[model samples]
Target: MLSANEIEQVYWLADSLGEPGQRIDDGLFLARVAMHARELPRNLRRFLADFRASNRSPACLVLGYPVDEVRMGPSPTACNRLREKTIDEIRLEIAAILISSCLGDVFGWRLQHEGSIIHDLAPRPEHEDVGLGTGSRQHINWHTEDSFHPYRADYVGLFCVRNSHRVATTIGALDPDQLSKRHRRLLSAPLFTFRPDPSYLMSKAHPLPGTDRGGILFGDPENLCLRFDQDYIDWPDDIDGIAEAVETLRRVIEASLIHMPLRSGDFLLLNNRRAVHGRPAFTPTYRGTDRWLKRINITRNLERSRRRRQSDFDRVIYV
Candidate 1:
């Protein structure tokens, strides 16, 4: 949580960006945000630095930031959101970018939202029962985000622009003690498969590294790292005890499920590799009033992940 003065400082910085949409692809935009990030409250900066250093937990929550609700107007519908969005709606994005830049380099996918650096999470009427960030009538299965990709985000940053419904974001991490020795070995072996998420398959992009069979767990003890997707994995019944092991893993994760109901001005940085996240079903009002959030993906380094892009300034990956 930020003090009154700290909150004011954040707004001051966001205001300077002035309709950040124009600067999303420019190097200056990131540089300026990094500058803003450096000047964040000393305590907040320390906390972010620590969060980046530690791999123990799956989440870090920062609260009491500022949102320009009055100027933002109604929550945008999925159909014309981008067509009518104004400067006020993007102020929160600038703030989110600034704070997230403190942890790592921000990035986005070419196939997702046409390479927009910031993404939106809001319910769409047509996809109420579908498995998407825009769905509101079905439970989104918990999984490591973009689990199929090798270049997946190191952290998933979500900023609650306006969540009147108080929807809960599901969170769970493996606890080594909860698993039996046999199950740990089973899950650690390379016997699982993951399919790319639907959002990434909207358009025909280049053939990227296909998610061949891989282990669910990583690291020496195999408890610290995990890659899982309940809906997108291919089930191979040939492997012995694979089904039982997965079932056991599911039970353990369910037992540790943590539901976080975020409010406006809340920013949550979720460690994509260390934890799995999803959300429960909620009813949405079509009156331009629904739970809304600004989202971004960040990686540890820029140059390391920069590959196959058209130019150095282009952050979106085509492959």
Candidate 2:
């Protein structure tokens, strides 16, 4: 949470960026947002720097940022959301992405929201039971963001526009160091496969379904990263004790899972590499005032996905 003065400083920065006259994908528009990030409150920048340095599973929340609920239009419908966004929507994206730029290069998937860098997540009556973020009537499962792809995000930033229903997001973390050497070795083996979730499958191009296989734990031993998605894993049933191993890890995550209810003006950042997040099912009012959140995905090494990107400046990854 920011102090009153700090909150004012943050809002002032957003206000200074007049109207976002250009589309989000426009080069000049994105440059303008990143340039303005130079003026963010010093404490906020310092805190983000420290969090990045930790290189461990962590979740941080910032409250007291201004969000004009009345000014924000109703939650977007379930159709293709590639059209124009309201002024309030653009304002929040500018502020949200500004904070995100401090972490790393933000990117999106071609199969999700039409390569949207900034995503609007809200309940859509047509997709109430979907496993994606727009889900409302069904509990979204705990999983790493874009778990099926090696180019998955390193961090995920979410800014709440509104949460009239008070839905709670569940998050849990697992450190490989907590397990025995044998268990750690088992998890580190490339014995698991993950398929693309419905979010990517819904793309208009209807990309061919593909599977990705990798170890659950990788990276430096002291600052381990994880990749997990219970719904899409396809481990060999004949593998001895694989189920037990998965159950063991699941239990740890279940025990550690915590419920966080976000409200207007709250911003949540999750370590997508280590933290698994989900949301419980909730009834929606659909009164144009349903829960709404703006989301962005950040990767420390954008170049690593060059094969999947069209050009140097293109942040949208192709399958």
Candidate 3:
């Protein structure tokens, strides 16, 4: 529960960027905006309380206000000047907000591009092509992000700045209360593998460095942890056991799906371990006014445990 003043500040910040034709760099703008937004003592306490109540489990929580209220522009360059500020300024602002918001210490931030040039950014191909274009109509299968990575994100955040199509929907599959006993049993078994997609081998001109050919189905059965990509998984030749396991996971995902339509000014944060998320395919109009989302991968209190730090140059890796 954010205080009235803190909530007002968030609305004001969004309103500032809502002007037409603004080319604001999301990373820089968020960093500065967070400075003012993070100073509310009451709000900080509320955030800590909520986080503790949830057992520090990662889930989507929207701050400030909704997109319709903010009315931000459709252009990406609207606030470019704001983003051009010094890196130290940006870092300081972001760090302050996270600390005040009880989001734990800042770990890292990233700028993701969903255009033709950078389609396959993650190492796993099954997680590819999910970002909706301006107007495409493809339904993405629900799955985790780089579940194959030994150090997957503990938390993932997406802040929407612009959306022209207005039809992109992010769906998640994970509902503890709704899971069936059969689904639970299937998830409890170990019968899955992770391998680099064949396309990456040819493009990179070499084999992927950290791929595991015979990965298990569930990493932590009691916790019911899942890492699945229907498109990328290679089931063992002995099909009966593996098929049953895969089907069970699929049914559970279908049964527990949750849909979220993100708009500008809305930030969706989720626990990567507890939920598998994906978007329906959307066609990008490619017109200057296209759907653009700024993504930031975070590791809350788990940052120190993971021993990771934010990198200065945000590199785009094609996997």
Candidate 4:
């Protein structure tokens, strides 16, 4: 995905940054990346172009980029404890930000993860059973990123800095032609609702209504977009018909699953509206060398989510 010269250029960009983790004027930063992006490999530019044009595939992987092994050190045990000021971390983030700029504006949810636009995804033993990425023992069930929210990201970008033991990232995607006639009709109807996942709540707070009645399948019928969370979806007991449909949809999605193991210097960008992604239960050694990934959310348009955040310029959405 990156040539030797291109990698050097990216590192230079990272070095030029005055502060790490402190949100920059992304508009200006994006402009710089846009200028340098032309110097990147042709195939990479085409891949980003195709992905931005449509949301069809589960993900696009960019491999062979450089990761400064010595500078990255060990993966942080907790995202909150570490600031992204390290040289390697900033370089990795700059790489991600540059790739994301090709797709859209990068945004973050104020109530989720660390509320940082660029966040870490490393196993935290203490949250093994929680719904967040820190859960290690329990597989994080497949779902669209921020499935409970209407203004979810258009694409989710993940940059792997370290993953010595290949841990598989699971993805489920089903074409409309694969769905049964009845199942397709039901999912297209407004019969589904999602509860706020644990990520949206405080430690002991009760679950809140996350979305109004909405269709699980949206967009063009030929290339339907998905919105689902098996663990957080709320189905009325009395509505047996919709319940059966949901179950059928789940079966089809599971049957078409694809798993990919990301290695260092690989960035996997997923179309959040087109597929659901999760991870298998993998034991983690909280030691510094544990698997670590940096993630960011991208939206096609910044104005569409202005109502959710304090201002159009703000990247974090409180709602």
List of clashing residue pairs for candidate 1: none
Q: Which residue pairs show backbone clashes in model 4?
A: none
Q: lDDT of each model, Cα atoms only? A: 0.80, 0.81, 0.46, 0.76
TM-score, candidate number 4:
0.89
Residue-by-residue lDDT tens digits, candidate 2, 138-181: 88888898898988899998888898778988889996656767
- Model 2 weakest 10-residue run by lDDT: 18-27
TM-score of every model? 0.92, 0.95, 0.62, 0.89
The positional error of residue 13 in candidate 1, measured at the CA in angstroms, is 1.6
In order of lDDT, best first, we have: 2, 1, 4, 3
The sequence of per-residue lDDT tens digits that candidate 3 reaches over residues 1-319 is: 3456765655454444334443233435434444544444555557655853563253656554444422333334221323332332233223333433354322331222321111211112232343322223445566665565554555555555555467444555544435555655644454455654323333333324346543433444445555666666666666445566566667767776766666655555666666677666654444445555544544444434333323332222322
Question: lDDT, candidate 3, residue 226?
Answer: 56
Clashing pairs in 2: none
Off by over 4 Å in 1: 19-21, 25-27, 79-84, 204-209, 220-223
Our model 3 lands, by Cα RMSD against the true structure, at 7.4
Rate residue 72 of model 3 by lDDT: 32
lDDT of 1 by residue, 218-307 (tens): 776844588889888865798888889888888898888999988888999998878889999999886766988778899887777677
Instruction: Let me know the TM-score candidate 2 reaches against the reference structure.
Output: 0.95
